[model samples]
Target: MAGNMFGRLFGKPKEEVSPLSTLEKLNETLEMLEKKENLMQKKIAQEMEKAKEFTRAKNKRAAIQCLKRKKLYEQQVEQLANNQLRIQDQMIMLESAKVTTETVDALRSGAQAMRAQLKTTKIDDVDKTMDEINESTEDMKAIQEALANPVGGMAEFDDDDLLTELEELEGQELDEQLLAPSTAAPATHLPSVPTARVPAQAGKAQPVRTEEDDELAALQAEMAL
Candidate 1:
């Protein structure tokens, strides 16, 4: 029966059934609710107008009853509006979730590609590193051997020997100074001595000449002639 063609196919209007696109479906639902609300509001307004006429005719009870019904109708419309807003909020959340999923997938794919690239890239410095290590090892060995067998120990020992020789030379110099003449000033204080001057004789001193002086005078008188 589901596959069979209906008997009255000509008179029946073809109900256009549109496949709802995502946002279009939500909008269409919201629009349908709005239309229903508007229709309900018009009905409420008509009731209110009828109640106003009853109030003008002094029917207070009927007016109050109409106002209460209007309030209930408004409350229902408000509830429907809230539901529409909630649906919109859900739609927004769903779209955000979809975007987040796509972003995460892209990031994951990129990460995997990076990992693959890292695996493929070759680091060719192993031999170079080993060569450097060997060279450094050889240098260290040479240094260690040089330290173990130091050249010319005598040259290093000469500093101590030279110091000993200097000490000996200094001791010899001190001995020579002690044995040498002492030309320095005396250590004790002494009193000064006065020297005497001899006085000369006057001319009355008869025969005040020595034999040598008489001899010298005679020789001078002979030479004068």
Candidate 2:
């Protein structure tokens, strides 16, 4: 199979030509062409002076012939200038292409190196990563389980059982309240005792009383009192 002609067209220049180098070459070429054009203009002027001298010497035809030759030389110089411009354009394009090719090759090599490194790495490394992931999962599971089922001393009394007991105590208290007396009952009264009434005797103009009578009456009165 034959390679592409464009790819094989030219060998690399002595310098690894970059865009800047291409631009520098273009500028140098332009300056060189400009200098040549200037020199050609000076030569044209000298030829015109010579042609004027020939005319002053009454040789008009020869002077005209010299001017025509000078015009041809100027045309050739203009053609050279156009060729220099074309070469500069080609160099600029080539430099851009070279930069693009180098960038692509660097990227390709980097990708190839990464793939080679990946191939060289141990397959067991993935297993180790999986094991670490499983360990973390197990730790999380353990933490979740601990949160779901609390351990040790206070585990005996859950909130539901405590709430049920509290409700039962409240029910008992309500029953006790329901059984209490509505209004307080009055205390029982004791039976009353009957007393005899003494009758008063009629007076027979009551006898005059002696001291002994008075004393006997006093003693009876004292006994009755």
Candidate 3:
């Protein structure tokens, strides 16, 4: 078997190479083959064209020789094309294999990371931590509620007592006002007359003449005239 021969040649069991490295090497080889294949095709086209030119010049022997060389070149070009196609197929397989290998490696790494985390973490620790958190939360809520409600949060207002005190004050003020002096104004005032004083000693009196006495005195004076 090929495996046995490979082992015998290596003198021991052979280790496999990385798939990605193998694929890169194959890609290089494929590019080289493509270049060589292109060169071979060019040579075939040149030989065929030369054969056509010879046939047009009416040289039968030269045309026949050109045709023979063209046939050989065509055969070589065909073989190169087949080789290039085979190499392309191999490159495709290697690229697919490399992708699959990368996917498997990524999945394996993720699985290993998960296993490491699981080893360090335990369910009992999680439960204990949750219980402590819940206890702390409940204590904080109780403290907040106690702070919100202090002692004796009531209004001090005695309505009946206040009303009785106000009425007593108002009665006392009214009684003091009533006992004060009255300030009523009189309706009218009349002017007073002064009495005349009498003379203390008697004096000679001159007779005062009335209007009739004056008329009689004038008639006597006229008769005397």
Error of 3 at 96 (Å): 1.8
Supply the TM-score for candidate 1. 0.39
Model 3 ranges with Cα > 4 A deviation: 1-15, 151-225
lDDT tens readout by residue for model 2, 1-225: 145564467643466656677777777887888888788888788888989999999999989998997898789688878977887778778778878989999999999999999997777998898999999999999999989885687787789988999999999999999999977888543332232344545864544545565556556655665
Q: Candidate 3, residue 80: CA error in Å? A: 1.9
Q: Give all candidates' CA lDDT scores.
A: 0.77, 0.79, 0.79
TM-score of candidate 3 versus the correct structure, residues matched by position: 0.58
Error of 3 at 204 (Å): 75
Worst 10 residues of 2 by lDDT: 189-198
Note the clash tally of each candidate.
0, 0, 0
Candidate 1, residues 1-225: lDDT per residue as tens digits?
533446355445667643245657777887888887887788789879988998999999999988888888888788888878986886787678768878999999999999998786656566677889999999999999888764686546666888999999999999999999889958652332232444656755444556566566666666666
- Model 2: residue 56 alpha-carbon error in angstroms: 9.7
Question: TM-score-based ranking, best first?
Answer: 3, 2, 1
Q: Candidate 3, clashing residue pairs?
A: none
What does candidate 3's lDDT look like per residue over 78-181, in tens digits? 88788878878888887898889899999999999999999888999899999999999999999999887645633355668879999999999999999977
